[model samples]
Target: MTLALHRHGPDGVPLVLLHGFPLDARMWDDVVAELPGLPVVTVDAPGFGASPRPDDVARAVGRSAEPALETYADAVAAALHEAGVDRAVVAGLSMGGYAVLALAERHRGLLAGVGLLDTKATADDDAARANRLTVAAAAESAGAAAVAPMLTQVLGATTQAERPEVVERMRSWLAAAPPVGIAWAQRAMAARPDRLFTLEDLAVPALVLRGAEDGSAPQEAASTMSAALTDAEVVVVPRAGHMSAVEAPGPVAAALRGLYERCAQGSVG
Candidate 1:
């Protein structure tokens, strides 16, 4: 699938970032801007931005495999290999976090560190799974605008009440999202397995963060992940929500910068 990759800066171990559902690599622009010389690689997930849809990718060109985040991870690894990056600090938010975990499972050798922000290691409960399927059906039937109602749930109460502009921006993104991409991602996420075990053997440094006001990805979820990881710390971002990196880029950027510096150090890898 060789997802689209955008590189920034020329120093340090490359910090790879994955975006949440329906959003593309552009979501990381602000966070990347905050890190001056730290090399950064932002990837647009399958079917998002300029990348080809899953069924159109080289690996999936034939009778394609079922929708799975692991496929996306393989594409991510391929893209990195194409860019000549053998190792990197990988991070993600929401659905991106799910993909990050998939990559950790399938391509652990490529990870220097991991940042799990506003995400959980558990699989979706029956309710959540049904909701995802419902949303997928809606996206396929009505288009990306079907996810527009999710804006309130995705953003924090603080962001919704105090930063209407951010909410508006997200709304626009949602409206413009591709229906096929939305359906594929939603179904993939719904079928994902519980991945807390993925963190159990991860001896590498890890940063688990969640917005204090995040309803979607609770602090308990971050705690569970941090407890599973061998070497990890949890950071609670104030006044942010599921989209912490977007709601409050400063703290998210700082946390990511610290993680990159730690993993890029002479003694780590």
Candidate 2:
């Protein structure tokens, strides 16, 4: 869907970074700044950041009945095509992780490696799905301000206590997000399928990372994903939460750099 992108670095295996739900590509600024001399791309998924809305995405995907995650993945593929990237190390955070799995399922050949950060491989339970719909309806009715509290829910206690500025930055980002976009994301995430099998069948190097204090993606979730992968490494970043890339950019970037090197060398196993 001609998604907006932030691109940098030279010719090589591109690293595509997907931000979490309700957040734009700017979330990767800290992490991107740490990695030098590597081709990188950060995308604004449909209905988020500067990208088009759900209607525009549906038109770009040429299917109205398809799942939103798959459509978002298609948009990523289109973005990669525009950038002349045939293969890449795709890394996603939270909702972005969900999109990464969908991309693997739909566009496996394009992935050189996969990075799943602070996300789960399971689908939403009945209650969680219902809650997401409820939140979506609220966003549609009341706008982004209504969902501002979600920032507190997702950020770790350490961040809230020691990194007030980061919390404020996140609040600003959430508050400025388009309400329609937020609602669309909620519905899309609610409808995402369980993707554990995708992890089990992963043919590329896989890295599963979670913030030690991340409530959204707990340790157990990371273990489950690790167990399913044939070649996977599980890492827990201390003093971080759902937004590990933001809270612990150094460690997160280090892990990503290692993954990229491993993928580039074809030495994942």
Candidate 3:
């Protein structure tokens, strides 16, 4: 599938950004400003945002041995190749974080570094997977509009309580997504293999950024990932929820800049 991509900056270290499920490349808009004048590539996931929906959601992500993360990673790799980026600092949020780790494992040669934002590397517990399946069913039946508000509430920090516009924007983004796409992503995520097995073998610099207020990727999960990655650093952005880039752009950007610059300068690679 030809994924829709948005490029920012004309020159700099290559960065491939993957968005979470139920949202698309546009979710990175707030973070993009901090990366002004730096080459970054952001793509909409298959069946999400501006990307085309797959005829069969399960098969689209990867019902095969490779799993969905591999397909999503390859898509980003292809996007980078098409953009003439031989190597990049790949970053992803939530579902995107899983994709980033998948890339690190399957295509390490194509990446200079990795940023896992508000995501976990562990496989979903049975209860979590079952819950996701339930969510997928609801999304398939009730539609994106119905689930969007609930998502906003779950993803936002307490500060977002008064931000009707933020919630509305999230709603509009989710509502615009095809129900099949959301459901398919949910299933794919639930079925994703445990990536913890691959972390101990990592050879690249890594950043594990979690929202201080993020319930999905709590501090404990971040600590576990940091412990697994020998060369990884952890950054906890205060006052943010799942959307750290949107909630605390400055700190997130600082972390990105530090990692990318260190890699570029050949200090950590």
lDDT of 1 at 90: 95
Give residue 93's error in model 2 in angstroms: 0.4
For 164-239, candidate 3 gives per-residue lDDT tens digits of 6666776677678678777777877888888886778777788899888898888888888888886788898887
Least accurate 10 contiguous residues by lDDT in model 3 = 58-67
In order of listing, the candidates' clash counts read: 0, 0, 0
Q: Estimate each model's TM-score.
A: 0.96, 0.96, 0.89
Residue-by-residue lDDT tens digits, candidate 1, 1-269:
46889889985568999999889888888899998888899998888998888776536433265778888888888888888888889999999999999988999999999999999999999999999999999988899877988899889999999998899989998889988789889989999999999999998889999999999998789889999998897899999988999899999999998887778663434
| Between candidates 2 and 3, the lDDT winner | 2
Which of the predicted structures, 1 or 3, would earn the higher lDDT when compared with the native?
1
| Residue runs of model 2 more than 4 Å from their true location after superposition | 65-67, 267-269
C-alpha lDDT (0 to 100) for residue 78 of candidate 1? 86
lDDT of 2 by residue, 1-269 (tens): 46887887777778899999789999999999999998889999888888888778768767584337888888888878877887899999999999999998999888999999999999999998998898888988889876788897778899999999899999998889888788888889999999989887888888899999999888998999989998898889998999999988999999999889889889421
